[model samples]
Target: MNSFFHDENVALYRKLIAENESNPSRDEDRHAMLLTLLAEETAKAKQLPRLPDAW
Candidate 1:
């Protein structure tokens, strides 16, 4: 997968989490699910190859 997509997904997950927390009637289950997904996605993103500064 492309790093760009991974970054986008991470950003989206963060946004969703924020929204869920602020919601008056948020589902705990959904919040947990989103947090889990965000952690997994962040791990995957970190595993992606990094380009050298010269690049």
Candidate 2:
């Protein structure tokens, strides 16, 4: 679950980077939204506790 969230956050950052590269002047509002999303995903990843198992 944590890995999933981490992957998603990385994907989002990549998307934002692509968009910014295409449109050199990205709006401040869009940047803020991306930052907020990244923060939320990071928090969620941190909150997830380690799981114990043997297979």
TM-scores of the models, in the given order?
Answer: 0.87, 0.58
Candidate 2 lDDT over residue span 1-55, tens digit each: 6766686786877688568657867887877777777777777777777565553
Model 1: residues with Cα > 4 Å off, grouped in runs: 52-55
C-alpha lDDT values of all predictions: 0.94, 0.73
TM-score for predicted model 2 compared with the true structure: 0.58
Q: Residue 8 of candidate 1: its Cα lDDT?
A: 96
Which digits, one per residue and each the tens of the lDDT, describe model 1 over residues 1-55?
Answer: 3787999999999999999999999999999999999999999999999666575
